[model samples]
Target: MTVDWDWSYTGDILPDLLKGLRYTIIATLAGYAIAIVLGMVWTLLRRTPFAAVNQAVRWITEFIRSTPLLVQLFFLYNVLPSWGLSLSSLTTGIIGLGLHYSTYTAEVYRAGIADVPRGQWEAATALNLPRSRVWLDVILPQAVRRVIPTLGNYLIAMFKDSPLLLAINVAELLHEAFEVGSKSLMFLEPITLVGLLFVAVSVPSSILVRRLERRYATY
Candidate 1:
C-alpha cells in the first residue's frame, strides 16, 4: 500500500514543532547538567570512608534505580502539591528526569573510579595529598575522561526521554506533534517528523560520542 504525504500540512505544523523543539532541547540540557552534578555528588558520597554515609547513599541510589521513572514523575507532579509544594510542569519534569538519570550516572561514575589503577591512589597517599586534592587533582579528572563516552550516551538517552514530560503537559516535541495532528486532522506528517527529528539529533550525537571515545582511547 502506498502512503500519502501532506507537504502543506507539514509546513503549517513546522512552527509549532520548532517551538516545542526549543523546549525539548532546553529541558534536555538542563536535566543533563543536573544529572552530571548530582551523579558526581552521589558517587563521592558512596565512596566516602564513613560507613553510614556510604550505606545510605547506596540504598538511596538503589531505590531510585529500581523504581519506575513514570511513577516517580507522577508522584512528584501529583503528590507534592498536597503538602504545599508546587512546581511548574516544566520544572517538575526537568527535576524528575535529572534525578532519575542521576542514579544511572552515579553507577557509571563509580565504575569509572573503580577502574582507576590502585597505584594512582597509593601514589596520591605517598605524596601526602589531601583527600579532596587527590580526588580533584588526580582521580576525578582521569575517571571522568574514561567515562565521558558513557556519560555522553546518557545525555542522548535523556534527550530522547524528554518526550515523557508531555505526560505532565509540558509541551515538548511529541506533545506538540499530537496537538498539531489533532487540530489539523493530520497525524502522519507531524508524528513522522517528530520521529525523524529525534533520529536526526540522536544519530549524530551517538557518532560524535563514539569519535570522542576513540580519540580519548588513543591518549
Candidate 2:
C-alpha cells in the first residue's frame, strides 16, 4: 500500500503547531522554575529538626509523586472551582506539572545535598555559622552545582510532559496537532510534525545535559 503525503497541508498547519510549541516552551520553563524552587523548599522542610514537620513533608512529597499528574490537573482544573479556589486552565496546568515534578526534584536535591562532603558540614559547624549561612554559602552552592545536569534532565522531561496539560485545556504542542488533524481528518502530517518537533528539541537538550554531566564528572 502507498501512503499519500501532503506537503501543502503540512505548511498550512505549521503556524498552529508553532504557536502550540510556544505555549509548550512557556509552560515547561515556568513549571520547571516552580519545581526547582519548591523542590529545594521541600527538601529543607524534610531536613528540619522537628520530626512532625519532616514527616509531613515526606508524606506530601510521596503523595504527589505517587499519583498521576493528570488526576492532579483535573482536580485543580475541575474540582477546585467548587471550593472557591478556581484557577485558569493554564495556571492550573502549570501548578499541577510543577507540584508533581517538585517531588522528584526534591529527591534529586536530597541526594545532591547528601553527597556534599561531610567535612563541609563540619567546617560550617566549626565556623559557628548560622544555619542560613551554612546552607546558602557552604552547602547549597555545591549541592546545586552537582545536581545541575540531573535537574536539566527533569526540565526536559517536563517539556515532553507538557502535552499532558492539554487535558486541562492548555493549548500545548500535541493539543494543536490534534486540532489540526481533527479539522482536516488527516492525522499523518500534523502528528508526524509534532513527533519531529519533539525530537528536534529533546535531542539537542539531551546532548547538552550529557556534555554537562561529563564536564562536571570530576568536580
Candidate 3:
C-alpha cells in the first residue's frame, strides 16, 4: 500500500505539537523538582543509624526502582480516587513520575554520599560539628556537586519518558502527536516530530553532562 505524505498536515498540527511540548517541559521540571528533594530525604533516611529503619528504607527504594513505572502510574491514576484523593491527569503524571524517579535519584545520592572520604567524617567529628551541620556544611555540598552530572542524565531520561504520561491522558508531546494523528490521519509527521523533539533536547543535555563529568574529574 502506498502512503501519501502530507506536508501541509504537519504544518497544520505544529501548534498542537508545540502546546504538547509545553506540557512535556512542565511535567519534566515539576516532576524533577519533587524527585530531587524527595530523593535527598530518602537518602538521609536510609543513612540513619537505626538498622531496621534503614533497612526498611532500602527495601522500599529497591521496590520502587525495580517495579515498572507504568504500573506505578496506573496505580496513582486509578487507585487514589477510590480512597477519595482525586488528582488531575497532569498532577497524577507529575506525582507518579516524581516518585518513581526519586527511587533512582536516591540511589544516586547514596552513591555520592558513599564516595565521600571517610577522613572527612572523622575531621567533622574532631571539629565537634553537629551532625546536621556536618552534613549540610561539609557532606551535602560536595556530594551534590559530584552527582550533578548523574542527576542531569536522569533529568534527560525523565524528559524522554514524559511521553508515558499519555497513557493516562496527560497530553504531553507524544499524546498530542496521537491526538493529531487520530484527527488528521497523519501519524508520520507528528510522531517523527516528537522523536526529533526528544532527540534535540536530550542530545545536547547529554553532551553537557559529559562535559561536566570531564570537568569534575579534574578536581
Candidate 3's C-alpha runs over 4 A off are: 1-4
- What C-alpha lDDT do the candidate models reach, one value each? 0.93, 0.93, 0.92
lDDT of 2 by residue, 110-213 (tens): 99999999999999999999989999999988987889899999999999999999988889999999998999999999999999999999999999999999
Off by over 4 Å in 2: 126-133
**What is the clash count of model 2?**
0
Error of 2 at 111 (Å): 0.7
Residue pairs in collision within model 2 = none
lDDT tens digits, residue span 3-119, model 3: 776888878988999999999999999999999999989998987899999999999989999998888999999999999999999999999999999999999999998888889
Worst lDDT run of 10 residues, candidate 3, spans 210-219
Error of 3 at 186 (Å): 1.7
lDDT of model 2 at position 8: 94
10 residues in a row with least lDDT, candidate 1: 210-219
Error of 2 at 59 (Å): 0.8
